[model samples]
Target: MKAYIAIKYHINLENKELIEEISNALEVNKIKSCCIIRDKEEWGRKTFSVEELMSISFKEIEISDFIVVDLSEKGVGLGIEAGYAYAKGIPIITIAKEGKDISNTLKGISKKIYTYEESSDLVNYFKRLKETSIIHNSI
Candidate 1:
């Protein structure tokens, strides 16, 4: 089973590296992502667009078995995606940077939030999430 990962793209040049680093981690782990990129028709920042696109993305994500989120930046969009996935009855896997705090909206998620200090941490967390999702679907 595949998973859709929601991540925030930091607009700052310095933080853009952070976005790419995190996105690469998702690809390396083979978790499908809900990241939005440049397009003439697309307006607003990547994370900001989540509020507008959550329902649409949720339909695509629901095609898969689970949803994983990167809440390192604590963007509102990640929260929107997480909530949508939760409401859709899909299991949620949250990945947060080691020093970051899980937002109030995401704090109460029943499943454990995998915390990562580096890209490697993200990779390992995704592996665990994938295996758990596979087992969950089998039952």
Candidate 2:
């Protein structure tokens, strides 16, 4: 099934190697994934109007069966995308570094919240998520 990964843009710009590891994990678990920052071709084009761009993004999130929100850092865009996915009836999985405080607002909307100390934590979680239907259908 298709999944959209909502992550901070800075993660892409700075720690791309880590993102690659995450991508590998997703692929190993049999999920087709897309990330806005990693897929520059999806949004790097010039001359697109704001409305058009938003529509494209919204469409992607809507098409995905589920969303994975990386709460490793504070991100306005990530929060908005996760909220949009939640509103659209898509299951959401939220993950952050151990000891980080995730807002209750986000917890209420997510099907599951994982606190990770390393990439392996996320990788293992994704592996499990793929093998079972743990999605919470309620809004």
Candidate 3:
């Protein structure tokens, strides 16, 4: 299935290990991802008009079957993407660091909510997702 990872872009850059762990896990399961967190050139420090950002967001959402929104930090942009995906009826897995205050307001709309203490936790989640066959086949 095609998936999107909605995460704190800046945090991922600072924590390369976090991105690597998640990417590797997804790769193991053969999941294709449109992960904006790593697309530095398109969404880096360079500022863009809201119209441009929204256009990219819309295209990503259109091609994705599910979204894994990492609320490790409360990212406004990620929140917007998650909300859009929720509105489109796409499945979402909202994740955060254990004890992190990810607002229930956002979690209420998610198909699943998970909290991790370590990177391995994320890998395990993906494994479980794959085992359950919840990642829908790509169109």
Candidate 4:
């Protein structure tokens, strides 16, 4: 299965370890992830217009089986991505830090919402889901 990772672009750069942890968890479950920031080289180093970026993101979402959105920090792009995925009938899984407040709209559209104290908690949750075949069945 493949998952589209939706996160605030700035946060992605600042929280590399957290992103890496999530990416590793998906990898462990054999789920490929597509995230623009990490895959920018594939699109070349040139700057893209906002429309160009959204076009690319929509295409990525089109091919993905599901979306995993990090709501640790809010961003308009994250909501747009989640909404687009939802409209496309792609499953959405949301994750946030333990104390973060998740938007009700986001929660309503998500198949699952996970809150973690540490990145490892996200890893273990994925591991558990894999063992139970929940990930396979859900998405």
- Top model number, lDDT: 4
Tens-digit per-residue lDDT, 53-127, candidate 3: 677776898778888887888778877888898888888878888998878778787777888998687777888
Q: What is the lDDT of residue 22 in candidate 1?
A: 61
lDDT of 2 by residue, 1-139 (tens): 7778887665236756556666776787888788765664333343346576467678889878888887877778778898899888898888888898899999999898988888876667887776565742332
Worst ten in a row by lDDT for model 1 = 37-46
Task: Give TM-scores for every candidate, taking all chains together and pairing residue i with residue i.
Answer: 0.69, 0.84, 0.83, 0.89
2 versus 3: better lDDT goes to: 2
Candidate 4, residue 101: how far the Cα is off, in Å: 0.7
Q: Which regions of candidate 2 deviate over 4 angstroms?
A: 42-52, 136-139
Clashing pairs in 2: none
Higher-ranked by TM-score: 3 or 4 = 4
Cα lDDT tens digits, model 4, 1-139, are: 8989998766226766677788888887788999887785343455678889899999999999889999998999999999999999898999999999999999999988999998877767877766877666766
| Candidate 1 residue-wise lDDT, 15-124, digit = tens | 55555566566678775454453221132343444444655676666775667677777667777778877777787777777888887668686366777777667666
Number of the top TM-score candidate:
4
Locate the minimum summed-lDDT window of 10 residues in model 4: 38-47
